[model samples]
Target: MPPSRNYMTERLPSPQLLLRINTLRDRALAADSLNALAFSMANDAYSLLQYHQALVLALQGEQAELLCVSGLAKPAEDSPYLVWLKRAGRWLNQQLDGNQPVWLARADLDPPADINDGWAEWWPAGLWCVPLHNRAGQRLGLVLFLLDAPPPAPLPELLSSLWQTWSYCWQALDSKRRLPRWNASRSKLLIGLGVLLLLLLIPVRQTVLAPAEIVSREAQIISSPIDGVIKQMHVRPNQQVETGSLLFTLDETTLRNRAEVLSKGVAVADAELLAASQRAFDNPQSKGELTLLNGRAQQSRAELAAVKAQLARTQVHAPKAGIAVYSDPNDWLGKPVSTGERILQVADPAQPAMRIQLAVADAIALEPGAKVTLFLTAYPLTPLHGEVLETSYQAHPSDEGVSSYRLLASIEGEPENARLGLHGTAKLYGERVLLGYYLLRRPLAAVRAWTGW
Candidate 1:
């Protein structure tokens, strides 16, 4: 006889694992209290396996009642750690049904905010869960081992054996048990489902809110007609003005000085040509000098006329009768501007329209003639209605650096009430869509981006 042929002993793992399992099992049996045993099982199991943390939850009344966590003697019931752990345990219970161990990852849960998106921050990348079953084959509790690295090849099987034995002892020590599942009335369940379906199917308008401002369709933009420094602003911002009303002026000192210098040069050339003509009547050599002097006189006069033209352009004026729209006059004062650089807009107050900046992230399918409602920031209660008059095919960066599409909408009623450059939030309505799609559109898009499916 060879050591009495113990089949159970031979079926056990290597000696190292066997010794570790036996050690944890002895500790579980040695506990004198339920809390002590729970702590031992929650913490002491780490000596036999490699894991960063552990969570032990007991099944109570169809809910996972968290008993203890590794490395903590006692944690408050309402602590954030325990709250999130309980949610994880409930999700694990649903995942586990048979008397076996399972590996779970973030992808399996598709965690919501309640479960917290920062799963990896609190837990480890590698997760192993053991669903503890009673001798009657009913799920009694759960054990979670979080690992930062890969587990040993024999880790799961050995841990399973040790967990099964400890769990059996734990159930014998504790009095609470899992409640059996209940079946509700079929009529009531069906009615609730029908109501939920009807609610989800309700039609709702697809809407996107974007930053908007009251703009003019036919406004004349007053720009710097020449490259010069802004000298004066004749009309205040949003001030009423008639056609040819002075709006602003550039620095005319430089142009005026240049014109004066050229005018004097023309006078000098005329004097020189007249002297050359008087000398030409006396000597032939003076005749040649007269032609050159006459050419210089004509060139100087042409330059003087050009300088006067620039001096006239320094004073910008309103092209059409309307309100002047621009930033603070102080900001533009002493500011050098290039020719054709926009300084202000002369917009017709009676023909105000909405200019919406729809961000790329919030952009929806929009076309001309779409319905729009603008709620001014100052007067949010009274909304101005409009229809989309034009939409840009491409996206351009807004002042805030957000890429957005430009939309022009016509104000239907009380256009006179809407002032040019007034800021507001525009709600652009699209074709009617199901309520379910309207609500879940963003969430589904996020999930699809995450899963690439």
Candidate 2:
């Protein structure tokens, strides 16, 4: 009889046994753990083979094949069963397109005849092979088995069920391996793009935006005109004043008294001169007396004028229209002011200007009317636009151990509240040239000067 007829002749499982098998199948299907599902399938296959007097094996793929044998004995590395597994892997790769299942019997097992001589003594009589495919329908591994003796009948339904369960386990394992690699590749790509964008933005900022502006030190001091006591101050600190506005008064009481005494002497000299002139005209012999009196009167008048002028200068006035700034007074209030001592500053608020100190080398290349942009520490948000108004022909020594030219620029649209001596920096645009010239100009100039190239 054929194997199919023999399998049918065997009695069908009892209802109770059928119910238990169904329960185990349901539990395996609902299992959340992939390992649990794999082990459950392996155990079920083992039980069925034992009851039916056969052998079974399960296989998983790594770099090499892993075989879980359920038979009369465990196979050694050189055993016939392991040799069959290696051959099965090669055959499955060729015939299955690495997908689907392949079943084998005595006629199907095609090991070399010489190798099979030992297999007849130690190996099982029957063989079954199933290819394990993932969800993508790619072969992940193979499952194989050998029976202790030829199965009483071919169990096609059992083999089909085993193939289905093995496929699910392989798919779960493949999913776990592939997801992390995909996520890592995606993350690296995004990070690289972000860094590239930041690098691209750097040059735009350097070329289009203005830099900070600075003021030179020499343009900011206020000095006194003469030596005298500061008797009264007419203006407060930071007050705005026009040219000739009185700022303070010095002690002038003594000068005023001297002026009054000179005035009385001038009056007496004038009366004497008038009397002498009248007498000279009335009597010719009085001519010498008239000349002496006239000389005396003229000298008295000159003295009076000198004393009056001295008194007038005792009050101090502004030299220019601007915002007044008092420097460190050094607590000198009500004290005498010496000649040329700086008392306060009067900065031109309406026509505010900035000074740039350029190195002698840089200054030589700069010409008047070159563009400049100024940035003050106090007003960082707005830039003061201007052009080089003037450049000193002579260079002055600087703290940087080099000589520099003082370049002046008139600040455009002077701010309403900008004070004198506010700290700032200036960037000179120098001369216009081509983009290529801009890049090579500095280096070439330096090399030519250094090596005569």
RMSD per model, one decimal: 16.0, 17.8
lDDT of 2 by residue, 1-453 (tens): 698887875656456555655655675667566545544554556545553222223334333354434433334878655776565455445544445444455556576665455456554565545566666676665555455443344445544564666577556654664556454587799998888666544432112122223343233465665667777777776788888998777788777788889889989999988887788877988888877888888998898888777677777788777766764334456888788887777665556677667776544366777777777788868767877778888888765666777777776665753556666667677544445455555688889999997
Name the best candidate (by TM-score).
1
lDDT of 1 by residue, 1-453 (tens): 566567766665778767878898888888776677779878887876667888888887569888778898888998777778777777778877677787777655666676645476588665787787777787878878887655666666666667777777877776544365667799989999999889989999999999999888878877888999998888888899998888888888888899989989999999999999999888999999977998999999999999999988887777789988888999999999998898988888888899999998888788898999999988888899989999999999999999999999999877445877789899999989999999989889889989999
Q: Which ten residues in a row are the worst by lDDT in model 1?
A: 173-182
How does each model score on lDDT? 0.83, 0.62
Off by over 4 Å in 1: 1-204, 415-417, 434-437, 443-453
TM-score between candidate 2 and the true structure: 0.42
TM-score of each: 0.59, 0.42
- Looking at candidate 2, the ten consecutive residues that score lowest on lDDT are 203-212
